[model samples]
Target: MASMNDHPGERAAADPVKLIGVRETPLSVDEVFRAVGDDAAGGTVLFVGTVRDHDGGSSVDRLGYSCHPSAEAELRRVAEKVAANHPVRALAAVHRVGDLEIGDLAVVVAVSCPHRAEAFAACRALIDDLKREVPIWKHQTFSDGTEEWVGAC
Candidate 1:
């Protein structure tokens, strides 16, 4: 029987989550895309999330994102989970915090895998799990003098 430690490269291959962050500045799609580039990957998928003009049929005047101190760690956890479930060769994710106008990039995530379907599935799972599990909240001000905080719980 061969010990796993005999192959250090295989050990590193077990954990493919590369980059994870929460930034106060704007998010960059190109940066995230470049971070996940891999020579061994056959497919790379990138997903950019932007602030929209409206939500729930109401005009959004502006919005701000806030997060707990552990948000970055939580994001890493989500990315790791996605990598573990897929054949992820590389992965990167970043979310912006601060006031943002409509059409501003809010989040960027990318994944590279051995196949197109694997890349797509991993990228989708990364973003979806980050949104659902991260301790980030969005405060939206509506045009009609109303405001709401989302994902606060």
Candidate 2:
């Protein structure tokens, strides 16, 4: 655990969050996988979320993602929490917003740790927290012309 009196820069150096971002452009799995690369890490986990073809028995024609201004900060906070709870050597996460079609990548996250179990747990925590805590919203347009928005808040 980091001491409360520890300098922010020093703490960041000791436990680095390698990459964090919310982008309107397309996301890359290779980029995220590479970002969390660490020489000392024995295990790495990568997760990718994609826009699927259907939802709730309805065919999805397209999907759009939107977010509040504080979304990136919230994502960083989630990453920090995961890092604090695990032996994370490196971590990275990126989410895509704006218009998207079926099969488009929606999110990518990766974590590296000293062991495979730690890495898997940390990566799962990162994604779960981000989805629960962040203000990113998803809008789905069904083939029948119905639209819906989904988010925590």
Candidate 3:
């Protein structure tokens, strides 16, 4: 057990939550992965979501992401909830917004735990909840020049 005199965040550091949001800039998977690296963690799982060239079998020209002002706050809330529910040693998540090209990373998340199963489960929950809970919208431009918006709060 860590003593109180240790790092102020040590005791609670088992669940370090890091939420990095890039509104107009590019998202860094390396940064997100590094944020969740912990010495005590026996396993770490990382998930990187990218923008593909097609969606629903339709050729997609490009895609864009937009977020509400409360997106970051909501992200933190979701991360906190996941950490509280799981034995998370560390957690990190980053989402990219603005115009994006095919093969661009739209989101990256990672979680560390004392065991491999725990790390996989916790990492899954982190990304699943983030995509559902965050007030982020996706704008897609199809090859037919049609556009559609999905998932906005």
lDDT, candidate 1, 76-116, per-residue tens: 98888888888788999999998998999999999998779
* CA lDDT for candidate 2: 0.90
For each candidate in turn, the TM-score is 0.90, 0.90, 0.89
Kindly report which residue pairs in candidate 2 clash with one another: none
Query: What C-alpha lDDT values do all the predictions have?
Result: 0.88, 0.90, 0.85
RMSD of each: 3.6, 4.7, 3.9
Model 1 residue pairs with clashes:
none
Residue 68 in candidate 3, Cα distance off native in Å: 0.5
Top-lDDT candidate index: 2
The model with the greater TM-score, 1 or 3, is 1
Q: Which consecutive 10 residues in model 2 have the weakest lDDT in total? A: 6-15
Which whole-number lDDT from 0 to 100 does residue 103 have in model 2?
93
Error of 3 at 100 (Å): 0.3
Ordering by lDDT: 2, 1, 3
What TM-score does structure 1 among the candidates reach?
Answer: 0.90
